[model samples]
Target: MKNVSRVFYITLALVIITVIFGAAFPAQFEGITGSIKSYVATTFGWYYLLLMSALVIVAVSISISPWGKIRLGKDGEKPEFSLPTWTAMLFSAGMGIGLVFYGAAEPLFHYLSDSPTAETGSGKAFKEGLVYAYYHWGIHVWAMYGVTALALAFFQFRKGEPGLISTTLKPLFGDKMNGPLGTLIDVLAVFATVFGVATSLGFGAVQINGGLSHLFDVEVGFTSQFFIITVVTLLFLVSAWTGLSKGIKYLSNTNLVLSVVLLVLVLIIGPTILILNMFTETFGMYIQNFIEISFRTAPLESDNRSWLDSWTIFYWAWWVSWAPFVGMFIARVSRGRTIRQFLTGVLTIPTLLVSIWFAVFGTTSGNIQNNGTELTQYATELVLFNMFDQLPLSLILSLLAIVLIGSFFITSADSATFVLGMQSTNGSLLPANRIKIVWGLAQSSVALILLYVGGLQAIQNTIIAAALPFSFVMILMVIALFKALNEEHKKMEAEEEKKQNS
Candidate 1:
């Protein structure tokens, strides 16, 4: 308790101080953050690609190997939540707001943007657009989450260790995880989780404000965004007070249903056949070109290299930043499941849903673009609402979309609070309510500060910068987890031998 409290307060003080500095000196902060982000991306672009690829390989290998049978908890334990509910929570916490925000915008951007290998506004460009969208949102990002979640679940559940990111590396470090090094690691995890989720919260607030403006004639600016953030933060804190099983679970379930309804409405009222065909063709292209797309840095082509850094590198960094929060939440909800089942669920389900979502929304937007409607002319944040305008019952669907985004905002914020509390409280499965509330407010404050500092782009640059060091942390975690798993396997084998001898 003493150690957890000390770490929690230290982390809280550091985060508050940083946010204050950023808010007070917005230009200086953005300059520093932006420089660091560019340096990391330009220098280590290949490293990010290689590391992400290795993570995917490791996750897949572990799932298919004999280790697949190893339960995250005890051998006889079953899953905590049913498949459907569990999947809902995973999607909600993982990338619910992102999918909604970018489903229409990303594909359209890719379609219109210049590409080195594909000509803009051509058939190849359209295919490449959806393909890249899948590449960004697909197995790689989930694998990053899966590896971290698997390590945490194994150490915390199976081995009876604390849920801190440092604790997962206890196999290699032994007691050092209890020392200053461990404190540093845990502090970094908290920082990463808070900023990562704050970035999402900032996005949610902007999009929600945009939705309101589109639907209700409300104004759109910092005032509207701040108001949305304030109100939604209170809602999430109250939801956090209700605890995970009731508050988060119910919201996640509702989010999934509403999301599905929106997707269905878009499909039915939009070009239904075109979306279906786009899904089939896009899925095929994504699978076929997955490897090339994953490793393409446009090394020889400077212009294409710039585009790669802006889009693909940024996405990888964003996902890595998010791994701690999403990974811990997934680990919390994924107790008593086998490695195979966990990987399958995390990697497959959400990727498929994202693909379908991008197909429907992306293709519909593309159709509008082709018809001279020029969907991309609107701001990226407003593109989703604009696409909604083209369909039947635009008003109702737009309102529902706002409700869905707000629900996702609350769920994501509350989940981060829970994860942050757990990380700060020595990985207690049920962290104290006071801690949850404190972190909840802190997360909202960071978002509010970032909004004032430089809005969405500033939030993104901060996330990419923060994610740099943690990417190395994730790599070390993979090594430690593999070592621990191997030791566990040997111990199990020795126990079996002893029983036979007896």
Candidate 2:
């Protein structure tokens, strides 16, 4: 554990030094920026999509009868947390800032552009746009987190390894990968997690800035960004310090409630008929074209394909970027769960809910933009603030919306703080409170600096760059997990034969 802490501290020092030097001599680091951009654009293109797709398949398979029995928890130990609490924490942690940012924007964007998967002039094409949002938000995304979590939990808790991602590979590699190689993998996971989560924190800070601007009639500038970051940082740092059972769990619960309230308000105030119709049709379209869109790899020059790249490819990469943090958080919360329960509950349920959110929010926003006398031109004029005017309960809804967004950001930050602290600790599921607080503050500081560097795009691009290597790492993780499972089965068989002979 001390070794682990030392490794993390070294990495932390390097990252901080790099950031300070880059900020001081931005021109000198121009090549670094270009390199990060190229890596994100070229390498993370299709591999992320394929990795997510594969993870979903594995989770779905585990949800069925036979394979689920191989879940790696110990016998006679009951669950530490209830299903609802666990589910909410996992869902909120996984959804993070993306749901808040895209919930109202994606459906509207799709409706304006039409579904990328649908044939032209199909009156049904617009409906499929909403469905695409749902499809992207649904089960497949959560499955990625589910597999990563299950691997960590089963191997760490049951196998008694310190609960690290590298330890999860032990079933397959035996002792070979357990030395420096395993530590390297763990470090990679940490790198991906920090950069990816920092992206969300940066975005959350921007959204917080936007909301404060709207609510308080203040200008959008340094003061607003600074204020929001300070508040959010304090909130999440406190939660992280408080530990998961009390702090993270409570924050997640609040986030879910506030999210629902805002969604319900939108549904009630907006055109119910259009939202429902669009949701149903979009769901159908997504289901019908599931395989096609799921595996799409259209070249950069294809017509209407840019839309796919902008929407689908971008989302897949974003989710991949997010995998390490969400996966690690899920692993922490998912002890005592069978593979089947973990898959269905974590992957399937959250995906369905996310789809519904995109469906409802997207359809409502789209309908207003397309048909409403006030909204059509309104949407064109206002980008992030577009959702504000479309609602009948604009003022009340804005309050709820801001609350939900803030809570979502805080919940995710708190969870990440916990995971990063655990990662840097003795590989224990539960680490010391001070370490969690330190990580939380570190995250907040990065977010603040990124805000200074021109807001969310800078942070997100950096994260995408850092995630390039780990995208391949996740694939390796998938292979390692299955290989470990196979080896475990072989060991069981060998023991059974020996017992029979004795």
Candidate 3:
């Protein structure tokens, strides 16, 4: 509370107001958010596609260019965290609970319920389904995250600037970034972060309830989920107040180990051979059709366009909305690596790992469906748990998955608390604990309200709508980063030439 910035007050006020309105008039809140989601998908589908593609290209270019050698910190400084630890943090911040929630259900849906292009329930749909899941959770999301994270890391560690998003624009905006415009930018970022984290929290609570209700005799409604969120909220708040290396690092490493164990067991138990084959085929298809799908809008085909609206457009917006929180958190954990190493690790490692996770789960689920089990008839949150039920050691696997979700839930919320606190107080490395607690409550309240209003759908609609403004901010961030990187590279060249002359 001592070092809190005005951004905190304004953002808090905005979020409180939103929660009040949502709580007071749940129907209107849901209706307005749904309209915004539809409008964004229909009106700016092309813009999202292009913006995401450019971000990926920009991230790739930075990794391969001469500027890649620029260290995120002052020259000669070593990274604060070890390689494995850093990677774990990156993996955790990147996509913890989501992979669990949508890991299998997405592909199963595409193959059975709504094929992207192929006839529903056809072989082509089965194959194409995995490819689209790979596309959505693939390099595009990480690239957008990498570039934004790179910008923040370069400016904060190397230039010794504050870690706020607006500070990255100094090369473009100069002193104006320290003014009202900058405050607006930071507030918007905090607002987006709130929703992004809240959505994940909502998903985590619901899915945890889904797992419990499936495994135990628990009920499957807001009452159970409400308690789940309450318990996890207190747990994560404790972890959040603990310093990063102590709390987050341990939880994330645990998440990685649990994730690997679950993946291996499912691969062996579900459909081992088919998982590998699906991986090989879809990896190739994803690469081959990557460019076409990157720019595809399908204006002539209403069916395809509608699919794009629901899946692709929504995904693009989700990633952009998530970019700030992911970017800032990754930047915090990625302080000492060079630009090249940073971007390479960010763009490649997570993308590959996520693709494999999806392949294993997606392939296994597809196999189950093809075998005559109508898994799609179940709720989305219960799909993965039910899939586990069909495998060996079903009870143990279900328990492990619940623990994994719980850990990921805590880790994600932990990261969010710190990011929110940092952004709120002008990027303070050690934001006051009270401020974090307030934010923790704020985030949890938002998630609970969303659950009350419209559950998972309300979460999705809110995110799609929240992402639109931040997408423009992301564009500005890329421009600012490029300008700064180019100017710095020129200075490096001039100094190198001067050294030769001397």
Query: Quick one: best lDDT, which candidate?
Result: 3
Clash count per candidate: 0, 2, 0
lDDT tens digits by residue: candidate 1, 1-502: 4335456988899999988898789999888888888888899899899989999899999999878878999989999999999999999999988888898999988888655367889988887788889989999999999999999999989999888899988888889999999989888888888899999999999999888888778998889988999999889999999998999999999999999999999999999999899899989998897788778877885457877888888889889988989999999999999999999888899899999999998999998889878787788889988988877898988888888899999999999999998988888878888889899989989998888888887887888888888999998999998888888888878988999999
Order by TM-score, highest first: 3, 1, 2
List residue ranges in candidate 2 displaced over 4 A: 1-4, 26-31, 113-125, 176-178, 372-385, 489-502
lDDT against true structure, model 2: 0.70
- Order the numbered candidates by lDDT, best leading: 3, 1, 2
lDDT by residue for model 3 over 1-502, one digit each (tens)? 6778889999999999999999999999999999999898989999999999998899999899999999999888888888888888888877889999999999989998988789998888988988999899989999999999999999999899999999988888899999998999999899998998899899999999999999887999999999999999999999988878888999989999999999999988888888899899989999999999788887886557888988999888877878888999999998889999899998888889898999999999989877887899899999998888788899999999999999999998888889889998888988888888899999999999999999988888999999889888888888999888888889889999999999
**Candidate with better TM-score, 2 vs 3:** 3
Question: What C-alpha lDDT do the candidate models reach, one value each?
Answer: 0.89, 0.70, 0.90
Task: State the TM-score for model 1.
Answer: 0.98
Which is the leading candidate under TM-score?
A: 3
Candidates 2 and 3 compared by lDDT, better number: 3
C-alpha lDDT of residue 224 in model 1: 91
